[model samples]
Target chain A: MVFICSVATAQLPINWIDPLNEGVLQGRLADNDITGYNRLPDSVKSVVREPVWALGTNNAGVYVNFKTNAKEIQVRYTVSGALDMPHMPKTGVSGLDLYASNNNGEWYWTPGDYRFKDTITYSFGPVKENSHRIYRLYLPLYNTVTWMEIGVSSDATIEFQKEEESPIIIYGTSIAQGGCASRPGLAWSNLLGRALNTPVINLGFSGNGRLEKPIIDLIANTPSRVIILDCLPNLTGVTPENTERIDSLIQAAVYQLRASQPNTPIVLTDHSSGFNKNILDETDNTLYEQTTQAGLASFEKLKQAGVKNLYHLRNADIALDINSTVDYAHPNDFGMVKISDAYQRLIEQFLR
Target chain B: MVFICSVATAQLPINWIDPLNEGVLQGRLADNDITGYNRLPDSVKSVVREPVWALGTNNAGVYVNFKTNAKEIQVRYTVSGALDMPHMPKTGVSGLDLYASNNNGEWYWTPGDYRFKDTITYSFGPVKENSHRIYRLYLPLYNTVTWMEIGVSSDATIEFQKEEESPIIIYGTSIAQGGCASRPGLAWSNLLGRALNTPVINLGFSGNGRLEKPIIDLIANTPSRVIILDCLPNLTGVTPENTERIDSLIQAAVYQLRASQPNTPIVLTDHSSGFNKNILDETDNTLYEQTTQAGLASFEKLKQAGVKNLYHLRNADIALDINSTVDYAHPNDFGMVKISDAYQRLIEQFLR
Candidate 1:
């Protein structure tokens, strides 16, 4: 192994590698028609709603894996939208998050300093250790990666690592899409994937993850160890105005998935909101109450029908509080960790 | 009590009230020379370093307190700098964070939807209930507030609330200045203040909070319940290149404060970094180790000199980890909470 003695010499020749050519991309839906680093295949453009199609262009759950001995690494990529949302930081919306495993195989984040522009650049460490190590780079949670290239020192060796198979698949709303995590890696789904030592396919559509038949059909088609439905946030309303519609949507989604993958475990999660605790804000409290009750009722109905491997997770189990969210609707890194802990407790059994 | 019953109507006549006129602004260093919502008095502009003087213009610890019966409250304000930094969000840097105390005196965050532009606007609820309640609005943690106005409904009542006196004062660096909190209220100092039901004077100068005698003298002059020193991050380097300088700075700061206020509790916080746990990154580990050791040595030296009420807080107690930081240097909301817990535990006794 070659060791670069100093971090002071930052002018060392950098060798760029395309992650796609290296076969290091993970959490990408397997499709020949996928033209770039999009969450959905190009073929789905006509099949889904225009909003879903546009959001699909985001690189939400996508990541890349590789092994290298380079003391320092760099990434240059472009994002399609404004770098940030009003509540979310540019780091979570459009920047890269990197983690490396030590010799003991424990994963830890590699701190990076980044610059934002038409083409964003992130530089990660003069790590100072000469041993070859595995690295995972999580892509932007709420933005599209138009193109990306990884750079390593000229003398360092780099190789692609294969992804773990039979991923855990999550179909949910903006929270699942990593609405307001401080960084992409702090997203609950990514945290779960790392902790469980498995892969995850996040089908979290921002503001658009209603329990629709078309999306359910897509999820059923994907092979996975377990499937999670966390779309109650998008389906339930404040007054129970469409309780019947919500129940129908839930039943339809479950039935569709059961038809295609009868043995795969299905987990339904209730909406977790701190608004439920508010005594003064009736509207906020009502929304949380109606949504959670609707979700619980659907789980009970499905269980009575003798649906095997069906599970229910209460809102309380998810562990969200007023202090944990960014905009009272989305989880921050601390809330993400709590949600990840809840999922790991229930889903780790299936992964094992 | 008059209440506007509808949120649908956006054209309700608003009664704009200047917080300065109502005597509601808190956390400003007391001096007749102060002109606006700056943390430091204008008298220090020519006394400190240019960068230190400039950072003092930021409204890091400043907040507004009032009791309002308005169903909805709105703020229109202008900030002096760009809305955000690379790792931090605009919400924490430039947006206002609001909290309301319920009838039982328990404080809870009042969620607000915001629009960012030349004059940033934030709207907080047509809160269905119409009781007069106390509200605290935390200002931007990393931006200078040029001008601000709070608007309530024409028929509503708004009254100024006096701030708690003898605040716990913290003199430190970027973390103490609230670098990467998702919102202004989540800053460790803000969180501690709210939790303790006390006021906080945050004398945190971003990138320039070295323990210089000029700033220490300013802090010494300020009457406080407890004084905390968290400037080790700004003073320490990757290597022990300036160990003697760090020691002298700490000794001088402590001596200067002791000379003025002999009995007030002085707490010194060590640098908290997850890099200390990394097995592969020697540069990161070295930086963490050397800084932490330097801080501990100073604390030991001070204690050996029979300095009464001089306390030292270990780096481990700060509760930061790899997952807690945004860019490894600045703590996110999660890390901020942890650090707040540590400070609350250490300082609560003196406060009581």
Candidate 2:
């Protein structure tokens, strides 16, 4: 049977979207609830602190909302950067509640009370029922409070009838993990979800992202719409041997992803600017450019070998300027926006 | 006493002399010694694990022997981002080991074995004796070395030589702390040192460098060449009230520095980039520009009232193209070099 892969040529209309409400859900004890002492319970809340700015979620779920037709349902959210708290503590003694509702306000609660937060990321799958769902993230560490978003996913053509198998997975460094960004919603992956109106699984580890076997194994297991490999910046002072190792690691990861989700798109990126232009010698410049080109070449090679979807972006195309860099390397808020925009544009262009 | 400052100026030519071992010592580790360990105890007669590199010293007392004088010293070295250990460990380690020797052979034994490590930076003290000196760094923990650098300073000029002294204090976010640079040498502050050819105390804290009072107080107490402030990145979600507080904090720090140093210089910098060209909202742009301009204007008002050596670097001046940045915000190596050059030029054109 010759299966024709029809490229979805639907162009989502561009709308003036409001930024996601990337607010910190402060976990404060109720006025009369503290039984042990006068002090309030130290709520383990993820406060978007760096590049401190206000982000609000719009009423529209155009960015993060998704739909499909199947008996069971699956939902996911991207969580990047280091887990604000190390070792998701199980002793907090709070109930782990999943509050999900289709736009119709009909909510479903799990049969048993579950309490697990080990991973920085999560996915709820095979919901056993189908509906137009809007996820509401809630944690009852100290007390339960609803999350406020600066923006939401826009409308899509797909009718909410059943579950869809396709997923989007992002693999990268700190930015993927949400470094220096003000909030989780502002993270590019999350933003990308809002733009595409799909569920994305984020595999961004802070400094620990090295494109190693363990990480690739995780990527291999997940089905995704695209795989973004952004690991160069963290690989500072990487030698030729390590670089080669990374290349192979990427190949291995791509190979695994293909085994599961064939024709999945792959995007590779180089380290952003942190070097001094005045000091770049011809040899160093050539080598650096070659390293970047080689990564792209490899992706192209994969495409040639029938991997249809692959992409590459240079740090230069982003908004980084050495002078503008808050530190010699890390993007300040200004830099983050530029990076997000660049990622947005690329993804949009690719999807188109 | 119409004593001539020219006496000091006449000796400026001495500043051009290479005090390090022909720039060889300027890197993180030298290749001459098979034993990578530098400043190893001479008493140890045998070697088991030969160090990957050797440490070199020059005849001049300055460390690394690049260019130095009795009044100043230059340190250069490479730092491997992929080192086996963390770049700057914060534990029993007081700081990085730094030693100065006028006689190259004497680098083995300098009084107190001055440790350049500080709470958040590498620092040297009041040079007890005024003479030509060579400085050496002993990093005991680093294993897989990549890059090296050297730092220069003259105790007589910045510390001991002055009855009343103020330091050029830099207070800001990670950019001030030298983030994302391949090595410590590539950091803008280190580069700025080479340009100013003077002792500069770096206080760039990584993610924690908020424009807070404790930090401001720390800056206030130090004798400074000038104070360069860049903290908007860390102050992401700051409200008008908090921003006003930050402004007051700057004013207080500057006032205190002036109280001690009297005529020291103070330069303020604003956030370099905002939303990039895509979201070029005039209001946002105006607000960001005005915020920085207001900071400069405030300083100028103080300058008009007889405060000498006060300046501000506009965002336009600091924000270069994306090529200059590694990421959208952090500078690449080339960006570092450019930023260093720009800063040096700015200092030469205005401060000096």
Candidate 1: TM-score?
A: 0.94
Q: Tell me the alpha-carbon RMSD of every candidate.
A: 3.3, 20.6
TM-scores of all predicted structures: 0.94, 0.37
For model 2 chain B, where is the 10-residue window of minimal lDDT?
A: B52-61
Model 2 Cα lDDT, one tens digit per residue, B114-232: 22221123323323343454444433222222333333333323111211223345565555545434334445665565455554445454444555655555455555667777766
Measured with C-alpha atoms, the lDDT of residue A209 in candidate 2 is 56
Per-residue lDDT over B132-164 for candidate 1, one digit per residue giving the tens place of the 0 to 100 score: 467889999999999899999898888878775
Judged by lDDT against the true structure, how good is candidate 2?
A: 0.42
Model 1: per-residue Cα lDDT over A1-352, one tens digit each: 1246455554668899888676667886664677678777787787899998888888888888788888888999988888998788999999899987656767767888799998899999877654546788999999988889999989888887877588788888899999888899899999888878788888899999998766787788888788999998887685555677778888998888999998999999988673445433455667777887877888899999998899877777886765688777788887888899999898766656
Model 2 misplacement above 4 A: A1-167, A172-199, A204-225, A229-264, A268-300, A313-345, B1-199, B202-309, B312-352
| Model 1: residues with Cα > 4 Å off, grouped in runs | A1-12, A102-105, A128-132, A239-241, A278-281, A349-351, B1-12, B102-105, B128-132, B238-241, B279-281, B349-351
Worst 10 residues of 1 chain A by lDDT: A274-283
Give candidate 2's fnat, 2 decimals: 0.00
Task: Find the 10 residues in a row with the least total lDDT in model 2 chain A.
Answer: A52-61
